[model samples]
Target: MKIRKKPPQEEFVSQAVRTGGDGQDAQEIAFIDNALFHADHAEDELFGEGSERIEVADWHFISPSCLEADGPPIKTKVLTPKQEKLLFLRYNYARRRIRQAQIRGAIRGTFESLMIWRQRAQDARDALVNANMALVPAMLRRVNCPNVELEELISEGNVALLRCVDRFDVSRGFRFSTYACRAIIKAFHRLASRRATYQKHFPAQYDPQMEKCDLGDRIHRQRWQDSIEWVRDMLTDNQAKLTLVEQTVLLERFAMAREGKGMTFEQIGPIIGLSPERTRQILRTTLRKVREAFDKDTAGPVQLAGA
Candidate 1:
């Protein structure tokens, strides 16, 4: 039997692992691109056609000219078999972390960021609706109408949604849903209060009373204002004196680092659209300012309340 010469092991392996960019080997590049594409979007339909007609912005993968009979496969890095497996695992883990971070971010932004303030705002909104509902009964009783219909109240609810949007203060840490309900109920109450029947019970308070109407109303107004004022005072009293940049950085870090975990200073900078080194510098400066502000201004004995 004629014996055919066998290529050396190193040569055979080198050919298999060939990497270069002298000319793009479209077929080889397509294979590599396909792996990464599927890893990113499992259901993605990929066309390995060269991008001569499609731009990168269109998310097309095109093989370069190198391997199209013009040159050897374009040189490029490829993971060793072990490295490829590691890359696959690491990418999946990182993607999961990103998703978890997003959920945490939504929770914090929606209700947890300003917890107490949001609660108060929501309470106020609910109170407004309750107070408005109370008005209808008061109106009916005053008019002595056992036949008062339910339609008006339902219509009033729709109006409440609008009033909530107009009056809701995001700065108050209350969701619009909470505050708008109050404004809506208040509208209903105002509408009902003008009725001649309401005068029976609320006449004195609702302005049917001739003499004490102004006094009663002013007092009520001040009391309502005071509740809001109290929240404002608390916010101001404990407020940290962070610069805009500092706040931006803090929020960025809070988003990147979640669940009691923290991001690298490098990670935060990119989030806030800054360089990683710049991010670190900002952190040092901002932390110093916050500590000093808390130190100099914190209430009795510098005790922390979720500080």
Candidate 2:
């Protein structure tokens, strides 16, 4: 019996799926069109060159501890200048190949080759990042920020390092560490400045149990109490021209002179020797007279204040 080997494209796809490619390789390949490829070439002619293939097998193994938030400082052999340059060249070259493949319009036939280049580019970038992951912890040692946690500073520094990896120019004749260190320091400074500004605006931490100022509520209650006192005085002075029966009815219905709940129309009706409907009519008339008097009394003070 003979075993038939799968084609290169099918094999590569299977390998990608096993290695957590998550369909992004296909999407990324599909995203590279002629317009973007031409735009990238026009903007930066450097991306057009550097097609030399670089071996990535040596840098493929990234330590799991390097990615852990609470893990100890990552200790990896720093890349020499030659190795650094090669990694950048490989990364950029792989990206260019994807665009070139798209331009050729043979994506289906060249899918395996495109995925290989994409994986190579990603591996090169990851190798560069892992090589310098130690810089974040080293920088944190120099920073004395009590407000920011070590984990948070590390996260910011890692982000800055990744951005530096993407933006650093090997042709500039400078070390990657030099560029990355400056970028990380700037990120830390920005984080500190933002924290300082936030603290300035909000000096204290939030506390759900903290007592809030109730000045508005107190003022509202005081105004309501003053109105009640004025109404009581008006009834005492008979200023609204209330009959004796009307006065008694108002007092009982509202519980103005008592400590208990107010009486209902039925209860007030029996007390005043009238039907419930008649008692309601009398209450309504008394309220209208009180409201008119109160409004008249407040109008002068309001107009005077405005004048």
Candidate 3:
């Protein structure tokens, strides 16, 4: 597949050159575009559509280095002039709003619309963001590992920051720092997981065994009876080496789970003799096999786009 760059992404970067602060005024800062492209089309766990438009949804964080006049400048990219200005404006507003709320004793209300809306919520969240410069990075860096590269962590951080922005509710008596930290950690794990060669090792080729199976969707998941067959297909050599116990585990670990995401490593670790790492490797291997079978039967040229 041809890999091409997408439209520039927007991000912030700290540069080397220092601006002379005029008396009391602060120097304006510029933002950077640090997004890494994943595919030439809309790829998910696997690339889906679009021959030209690349998908950056899987791009990771490249955390930035903060030392001055020490080592060489970290490998970094900058955003366009327009995007930089917008980022500046966004952070400025976020900081100001958080500041006003703190100073004025303005406590927001709790999240109550979750019950009424059930599924669709327009005014879902209201919360205090990491307003002061003091709290923002501390909130975002909860998951940063010193062993990991800096720029990568920051890239993951941006995605986490956005997630926190979306899910935060100030009225809940929880600080934005607390909520944002968890989100950043989750985003970091997701980005880190992408480093695994899921695509390279497991390609879902077309199949015809089950007439109408579709793997690329959240909907149309196989029934328990059909799930048995699916799990069988997932085993190496198509169940030739799969034990009865292994099949049972797959049923509960993956097939029975909603959304087909399977049990987490911690959750599934005790059930099988293997550790979580081994379980993950096995699941990844099995999933690609099943997905390939399903795609051949249902998601191939036989189905319409978005079907």
TM-scores, one per candidate: 0.20, 0.47, 0.23
Superposed model 2: Cα runs more than 4 Å off: 1-75, 103-106, 211-307
lDDT of 1 by residue, 1-307 (tens): 9987646854443333232112222233211122443365432322224211111111122243321334344332322333323232233333333333333433323222223322333443343343333222222222322222345644554565535433333334333334444555565565555554666655455344554448887977576455334323433553556666776665455432234545667777766788988887887776565556546654523322211
lDDT of each: 0.41, 0.68, 0.41
**Candidate 2 lDDT by residue in tens digits, 1-307:** 9999988977765545433345444334422122333454532432335533334333343354644556566555777787887677666666667655545443355666766767877888887887777787766665667677667787898899988887777777789898888888889888888888989999998987576888898987676566657768888887889998888877887677887777888888888899999998988888777777767786312110100
* Candidate 1 residue-pair clash tally: 11
Q: Give the lowest summed-lDDT range of ten residues in model 1.
A: 51-60
Q: How many backbone clashes does candidate 3 have?
A: 18
Error of 1 at 204 (Å): 70
Candidate 3 Cα outliers beyond 4 Å, as residue runs: 1-149, 198-307
Which residue pairs in candidate 2 have backbone atoms (N, alpha carbon, C) closer than 3 angstroms, thus clashing? none
lDDT of 3 at 129: 24
Ranking by TM-score: 2, 3, 1
Which lDDT value does model 1 have at 168?
A: 35
